[model samples]
Target: MTTENKGAFYTGIYRNLFKENGYSEDDITAKIENTWNRMFHGDDEMRIYSEVGGDLGYMVDTGNIDVRTEGMSYGMMMAVQLDKKEVFDRLWKWTMKYMYMTEGENAGYFAWSCGLDGSKNAYGPAPDGEEYFALALLFASNRWGDGTEEPFNYSKQAKDLLHTVIHKGEKDDGYPMWNPENKLIKFVANCEFSDPSYHLPHFYELFSLWCYPEDSAFWKEAAHASREYLKIACHPETGLAPEYAHYDGTPNHIRGFGHFFSDSYRVAANIGLDYEWFRGSEWEIENANKIQAFFSDKEPEDYRRYTIAGEPFEEKSLHPTGLLATNAMASLAADGPHAKENVELFWNTPLRSGERRYYDNCLYLFALLALSGNFKIWFPKEK
Candidate 1:
C-alpha cells in the first residue's frame, strides 16, 4: 500500500472513534494497541512515527522533547478521555519512569528528551513541553480527585515542575532561556520563534488554576512579560514569526527551521485563550488567518511546493497538506467558512505513509487530535 493509503487507513480509524456509531471498546483497544506496538513500544522511546521507523534524532530545543512528549502526553490524555484505565496506567507509568523533574542548572525543572534508555540527550527548555506536562498533571489530578493517591501524587509533582520553569526558567527579558544553571539564565537565540511560545502563557494559566495567590501573581507577571516580548519579536507586515529572536525582541536570521509548523499559531492562540492579554489573542487570530490565506491561495497540487514568504520550509510536503496547518486554520475561524475545508484537508491528506519524521508527525497528530476535540483519544479515558 502507498504511504498515503496507510495514512488514510489510520485516519479512518481515528474518525471511527468519534463517529455517531462510535468505536466499540474492542475497536478502540485494537487501534491503541496498533499505534503503541508500531510506534510507542519501539526503541525510539515515545518518538513520532515516520516511514523510516521512529525518528529519535530530532530534538526540539535544549530540554524540550517535542516529539516524544507530545506523543506520550497525547496518548495518555486519550487513554484518560476514553476511560481506558489500563492503557492510561501503563503509558503513565512508562512516561514517569523515563521523564524526570529535578533541580538542574535552571531552577530545577523537568529535563526534556531523554533517550529511550532514559538518558538525558537534550538541554534546552521549551514552554510548550512544560505546559503540556502541567495540563496532563491537572487532568490527572482532576480525574483522580484530591484524595486519590496514585495519579494525583504524580500530578502534583508535574505541577511543581511547571512552576519551577515559570519562576526560574525565564530570563529578565521576559522570554524563557534555554536553561537556568548556577543561578544564571542561559538564553538560546533560536527559541524566539512562535513554536515554543505556546507554553509561555500556560505558565500563568496553570498558575492561576493551581498556584497559591502569592505564587500566582508572580506567574501572571511572567506570562504578561512573555507576551510583550512576543509582540515585539513578531513581524508586523507579513505576520511572520521567526525561529529565534534576540533578548531585545528582534527576529533571528534563521526563518524556516522551527518557524514553519502550525504550533507557531497554536502558541499564539493558546496564549490568547489562556490570558486576558488582548494583543496575544489578536495576534494569534491574525497569524492563524494569515497562514490559511497563504495556503488557500495555492492549489493542493501546488501546496506541497509552496513556501512560507517565499522561503523554502522544511517538510513542506508533510506539513501544509497535513493536519497541523488544517487544524491551526480551523482553530482561528472555528465556525468560519474555511473550517470544513481545512479540517477535511487535514483528515484526508496522504502525508502519513512516507518515511516517518518522528517530531513533525507527532506535532501533526497532536494538532489533529486537538482540532477534533478528541483529546481523550491521545490520553487515558475515564473507566
Candidate 2:
C-alpha cells in the first residue's frame, strides 16, 4: 500500500515478469513480436488487421463479421505501445472516415460499429470505445507528435473528444458518456448503467494531467471515482464483476448482461494495469488476488458464464483464451499464491485460432505486452 515512488509514472520501471520467471529476454521478445506479426499480417486464419487502400485499415471482429470501435481502438493502443506509428495512423484514419459521427446527437463520438466496407452500422457511441480512442490518440500525440490534418491532430483530437464526452449534455444537445453526478462512465452515451470493464482509472489518471487544463480536475475526480466504484461492482470474496452494473454497483440485468462473462474478464486486467501504472489503490491488489484465486483451479476449456457470486452456468465461455490471458495479466497487481501459476499457465497457452480468434488474440497480446514490460505510458515530449 505504500506506493511512494514505486509506480512506473514516478520510477519508470515496468516489471518484466517473464524475465523474473526465468524466460530469456530473446525468447520473450520473439514471442511478443511474432504474435504481433501474425495477428497483423499473417494468413487468413490468423490475421485480424486488414489494410485498405494505402493509408486506411481496420480490425475486424471476426466472429461478428464487422468492424467495431472496440477492436479498432484496442488495435491503436497496441500499435502505439509497440511504436508502430504507421499501423496506429491507419486504424485512426479508418475510424475517422467510417466511425466518426459528424453532425448528430452523438457528434464527436465514434459510431460503435460499421460494416467491413466502412459504412456506418450504428450511429450511437459506446463509452468503452471513446475512452480507449481518446487514450490511444493522446499516446500517439506524445509518442509521435500530432499531424496538422483532421484525425492526425492527435492530442487536440483526444482532448476535443474527451470534452464532448464529459460536456455534451450541457446545452441539451446530447448525453455525456460519464454520469456527471457520480463521475462513473456509462455503458453508452445514452445509458445510466455502467460496465465494470469500462472503469479504467489507469487511463483517467493520465487524462487528468494531459487533458485540457480546464477539465483536469474532473478527470482526477473520475480516476478516484472509478477506483471506488470497482470496489462495489466486484464481489468481495470472488472479485467477479457483472458485465453491466447500476451506478450504485448492483448488477444491471438488462439484456442479460448482469453476469460475469467476456466483458467482465477485463476488470482483472484493468485492475492490474492501474496498479502497475499508478499504484492507485490497495483494494486493487486484493481484488486482483481474489480474481486469480477464483480462477486458480479453473481451466479455460471448462470456463463458463457465471453469476458474480461464482455460480456457473452450463454455457461455455465464448472467449476462454482471453479470460486466461487477462487473469494472467492480473499478476501485475496480485501478489497472491496464484499469481505466478496464472502467469505460467498463460505463457504456455498459444494464441487462439479459428473464427473467434480476434477477441481472444487481442487480449492475449495485451497480456503478453503487459507481462513483458512492453505496454507502457508514453509521456508527452517536453516543449
Candidate 3:
C-alpha cells in the first residue's frame, strides 16, 4: 500500500512520530536518553566510547579496532544535541591532541584514522569527517559559548577548518578537499573523484551562514553544486548512487568503490535531514520515495551490494544495521506508505551488538534522533 506523495517536503516542520504515534512524552524522552547512555557508556562489549587519562575520549571502530574522524565528529554531534558538553569536549580534546596535524600538506586536516592509543593509522583526511566536524563544532559553539581554551573555541576552530577545506592546495603541499574546478567535495584532498555520501548540501547550506564570511559564498555554491551532483550521480529510477564518483557523476572504479554500498547509505539519510532542515527542494521527496520503495521489500540478511541501476551482486551488506538506519531516516521526506513502516521497523530494531557495533549503533541512534525530531539545529540564545 504505497501512498504516493504529492509534495511532503513542502511542509517546513518535521514530524515527531514518537509523540504522534502514541508513545508517552516520558517514554520518548526516556528512550532517547537511555539509548545514548547505553551506547556511549554501557558494558564494554556494547559501548563504542572510551575515556582517556583526564582529557581525551574516543569512539573506537570496534570492527576495525581503530578510531576514525567519522566517529569522533559524530560523537560530538550526538553530544551537542543531547547537551552533553563534557563528552563533547573530551572528544574534541582527543581530536586536537592526536588527529590534528601541525605542518605539511594536510596540516589543518585531522588524520582520517588512528589507533585507539591516538596514533595515526592514516595521514590523509576524509572530507566527510571534516564536514561533520565543522557542523558539530559550530553547533557546540552555539549551544555553549567558547570556553577560554585553544581547541575549545569551537566556532573559531570550525571556521578555520572550513577555511582550509576550501582554500587548501591553493599554494600548499596538498590539493583542496573540494574540486576547485567544480566545487564538489573530493574523495580525498588530491582525488579527482568524490564519494556521493560526502555531499551534504544541507550542512553546506548551514555552513554558508556560519563559516568564515569570505568563504560563505563558496559554501553556498558548493551546496548548489552538490545538490546538482547528486541528481546525476543517483540513478533516475533507483536513487542508488555509487560510493565513489567522478565530478561528472560517473562511478569511480579505481579502488573498487564503483558499487553502491555502505558509504552510499548515508546519502539517503543526508537528503532526508536536508529536506527536513531547509525544505529547499521538492525532488527530495521523490528521491526519498524511490529509495524507500526500492528497498521496502528486502530483508536484512538478504541485503546485497547493488549497482546504481539496481543490479544485485553476491556481496551482502557489511553494515546491515547502518543500512537500515539510513533507510529509516529517509522517512524524513518519504511520502510512500512504506515510510511509516520503515520508521516502525527501525523502532523495533535494537542496537546492533558485537564487533561492527560502532557504525551500526551510530546510525541507529541518529535515525532514532531524526525520526523523533530530536536531531536539530542549535543557535546561540538571544541576548
Candidate with best lDDT = 2
Lowest-scoring 10 consecutive residues by lDDT in candidate 1?
180-189
RMSD of 2: 1.1
lDDT of 1 by residue, 5-32 (tens): 2322124223222222243556445544
Model 2 per-residue lDDT tens digits across residues 114-202: 99999998999899999999999999999999998887999999999888899997986789999888999999888888999999998
TM-score against native, each model: 0.63, 0.98, 0.95
- How far in Å is the alpha carbon of 37 misplaced in model 2? 0.4
Using TM-score, rank the candidates from best to worst: 2, 3, 1
lDDT pick, better of 2 and 3: 2
**lDDT at 69, model 1:** 53
Candidate 1 ranges with C-alpha deviation above 4 Å: 1-71, 81-85, 101-107, 123-125, 146-152, 169-203, 222-234, 247-249, 254-283, 299-310, 313-329, 332-337, 375-383
lDDT of 2 at 261: 98
Candidates 1 and 3, the one with greater lDDT: 3
